[model samples]
Target: MAETMIDVPGYKAGTWVLDPSHSEVTFSVRHMMISKVRGSFGVKSATIVAPENPLEARVEATVDASSIDTNDEGRDTHLRSADFFDVETYPTIEFRSTATRVEAGDLFVDGDLTMHGVTKPVSFELELGGFGVDPWGNYKAGATATTVVNREDFGLTWNAALETGGVLVGKDITITLDLQGSLEQS
Candidate 1:
């Protein structure tokens, strides 16, 4: 398939910096083999080196591990403990793109995700939300990306066996990124 379909209107070639106030990182995982637990983290920073062709962009981002919020103080604290993120030792989660390509009319970013002191390759399906100019005269762009990863793969293997024939926390997790940024012409 042609990469033409991946084009974004009003796109600019430059270095893009994430607007922390407008970007978010969220995730959900099955809990107790029944419901799901959703939480969010603060984006420390994100940047993209976009060329004339958006597909050639290189992306790098950091997430504050200690910023996890799940609407429950107890759970949040547990998530920050050694059983999970171990924020004291690994205070940040990072992702850096290795490649970008269009597949079946969708954009995919291949990257390495580092979390809990472990690094592994992952792919995020990206959807460009287009580009536009902010009221303040800044050129901006938006996009959403998502991927699924196994918690154990990152050394987050803590779990409890449920007498009901399942586990306390599911193995797989769904992660999503909602990003909006301004372009700095190179």
Candidate 2:
């Protein structure tokens, strides 16, 4: 097994730019009370700024709402309508960090997440997998983050009643982020 270390020289603190081709922002939601529907946003951008020798960092990101896809055309269209994301009116879901702290080898980033014109506070638990220089000589860093949010809170309350006395979908949506960024040159 390959052991990954978090510590890396020259990456202690600075600005990093996300390499979109190597990063992914995905989410999953419980559907029909039996299984999960997984999806990902195709368009996203983020930036991270770390202070020198500091154990914390700041992050900001934006995701294009219309880019949501779950491999079903009909469902994707529905999600873009008022029944769910309503991507027509709200084109983007954004996050801006207010505070960040590390606990037990994980990074907790507290930020405000805005969706469907509604803003709420949320936290993402992040794990710094490691940092290194890629074959092309670019400094690379990897991290994974996750968080859960109530769909109702973001005005995504669309639901259907199942015949079995339960709703067609769950209120809580779990978002998982696998991010890779490169250190920016001054």
Candidate 3:
């Protein structure tokens, strides 16, 4: 049996490979300034390198743009069109961490996010879910991170004026990530 040790500061120094089967990247946005629409994107690959101080970990991830699912086929199709993600032109969304820090028991990651041919700096508050061993004996670590961004910043400015005087879609988008990673024993 392989044992994984997690120190008091959290995280073990090693390679952390995201387990996509148990992880997800989700987002939500207001619909017409009234209701909210939620969706998730399939992550293609991800990696996290935890040094001696886990707070300064380096991270990188890639998501399949065309794999977005909002539960509504029509809406999903529209989102994949040029008006939004334009998956055909921009098939992948990526993030590369520039810095990481811990404050008041919370971890924050600042990174450059590129989507739709636009790159922007974004920060996400991370909640570490601790490390454990799965039933199958694999060492696992989990965490959740969230951030909000303006769609227009990414050139996703498509919208429609509603009869009620509001736009068809909201500009602010909330992105949430539920990550489960496998710790590599070096």
TM-score of 2: 0.91
Candidate 3 global Cα RMSD: 5.1
Output the number of the TM-score-best candidate: 1
| Residue pairs with backbone atoms closer than 3 Å in model 1 (clashes) | none
Query: Which candidate wins on lDDT?
Result: 1
Q: lDDT by residue for model 3 over 1-186, one digit each (tens)?
A: 221222444456889999999999999999989999999999999999988766568999999999999999999999999989999999999999998866565568899999999999999998888888889888899999999999999999999999979899999999999999998876
Candidate 2 structure quality by residue, lDDT tens digits, 19-69? 899888899999998999999996478999987634457788999999999
Expressed as tens digits, the lDDT of each residue in 107-128 for candidate 1 is 8999999999999999999988
The better candidate by lDDT, 1 or 3, is 1
| Ranking of candidates on lDDT, top first | 1, 3, 2
**TM-scores of all predicted structures:** 0.95, 0.91, 0.93
Q: Where does model 3 exceed 4 Å of error?
A: 1-10
Model 3, C-alpha of 90: deviation from truth (Å): 0.3
User: Each candidate: what lDDT?
Assistant: 0.93, 0.85, 0.91
RMSD (CA, Å), candidate 2 to true, equals: 4.5
| Model 1 TM-score on a 0 to 1 scale | 0.95
